[model samples]
Target: MKNFIIICFLLLVGHQTVNAQKALRVYVVRHAEKLTGDPKEKDPELSPEGSERAQALAKELKGQKIDSIFSTNYKRTKLTGFPLADKIGISIKTYNPDQTKALATQLIENAKGKNILIVGHSNTVLEIIEAFGGEKPVKPLTDDDYDYLFTVTVKGKKVEVKTSRYGASHHTEGGEAKAMKSNK
Candidate 1:
């Protein structure tokens, strides 16, 4: 009876460990650079620099098990997510920008314990992050700025957030204004 009880305990512990390891990781990124043509165009594609940035973003996310990819029905968003979707062998799903909060909530619930990737426009990316309980505000990227990455991980009711700027030298909390890197 003692040996049987010990075996049962071990099995229970193993199951919990596997479940914890499967917790979801969601990455929200802004669409890469855009074409410089007329602003009146209904849908503009990625500019040359934007295309390069998309490739760079792909390289950054390589080797991760990205289960689902979500993007708005915009050319830039679709193009930005293409490389990563191709790398992971999954198709991109389009969500309504107006219903972003609801859509993100649904996806988060459906992805319970799974990893997901979402690509959005400058105006909505930060909003999505906030919907997920992030305290950071959305900031606009300049023509020369292209390397802003938000890595959000949710485990049970706990959350962790990290930011990596492309060419900038420092980080700030809760604002969109550009700050110069500290000389130190």
Candidate 2:
């Protein structure tokens, strides 16, 4: 009877241990292109090309089971996430761009065992990825950078990061953006 009790105890402990390790998947990206030409504009909406790119992002991740979507409280970031949020039937939650560490903590604590997407600025995307214990890409994000997609996965204490691209290529030949034909 003692042997049976010991075996049962071990099984219960193992089960609890397995349950404690939460596996989380997060997709992070800088907001798509914003309207340019105004250095004083603190919160500009996305350009028309950026809008199309946002729609492409939605199409890219629509099949994935995204539980929550987060964005900075800016027109660009919000617009970047709106397409996906609308497709997933979830609302976009705003987080402080200056408080990446806090947001990372919140994600780890509350977003365990789920899938998440975060839209941020070029400066903040890497910071948020690092805060989540994931590796940043080799190339630093710049104002002109807009096509990198980062996937951060956390299982137990293990963190893995992968980088890829989505939507229109921001880096094209001759440093010229593909001319977006205006609807007007």
Candidate 3:
């Protein structure tokens, strides 16, 4: 009977460990710099510096076992994620900006126990982050700036947030981001 009790305790501890390991790690970033041109330019491509930054971002995330990638259906976002996707051997999945909250929730659910990356616009990045219960607001980004990184960890129904910055050449690092936390 003592042996049975000890075995049950061990099993319970092991189960908790397994559950902890299943938490998701999601990285959300704004699209890299774009070419300087008219806002109405059709299908603009990334500038030379933007290309370099994209390559750098890709290198940073290489070998990270990214299970899936999400991007807006826009040229800049697509280009921004290209290098990383190529490195990870996964195709970019486009999500509608209007349905960002719903899509973000679904992505979190689908990517549980895995690592996922998302490329979003300046305005919508924070919304998605908040949808996941992140504490930090999305930082403001300019046309030439793209450095924000939001890391979300989800365990069961709880989510923890960590914010980091990359691509610092274009923008200052670290600023107060207003997070709009909501369960919706």
Top lDDT prediction, candidate number = 2
Summarize candidate 1's per-residue lDDT along 67-155 as a digit string, tens digits. 88889999999998898888778999998878977976775565667677789877777777777766563455544345677877766
Question: Model 3 off-target regions past 4 Å?
Answer: 1-21, 173-184
Model 1 lDDT on a 0 to 1 scale: 0.75
Steric clash pairs (candidate 3): 137-178
Q: CA lDDT, every prediction?
A: 0.75, 0.87, 0.77
Winner on TM-score (1 vs 2): 2
Task: Candidate 2: give the clashing pairs.
Answer: none
Q: How far out, in Å, is residue 125 in model 1?
A: 0.9
How close is every model to the real structure, measured as TM-score? 0.75, 0.83, 0.77
Task: Give lDDT tens digits, candidate 2, residues 15-92.
Answer: 767755877889999999899879899999999989998998998899879999999899999999999999888999
Off by over 4 Å in 1: 1-22, 137-145, 166-184
- With candidate 3 superimposed using the best TM-score fit, by how many Å does residue 146's alpha carbon deviate from the native? 0.9
Tens digits of per-residue lDDT, candidate 3, 63-163, equal 77888888988898899999999887789999998888897688666666888888887787777778777765544555444766778888777888887
Assess the local accuracy of residue 150 in candidate 1 as a C-alpha lDDT between 0 and 100: 84
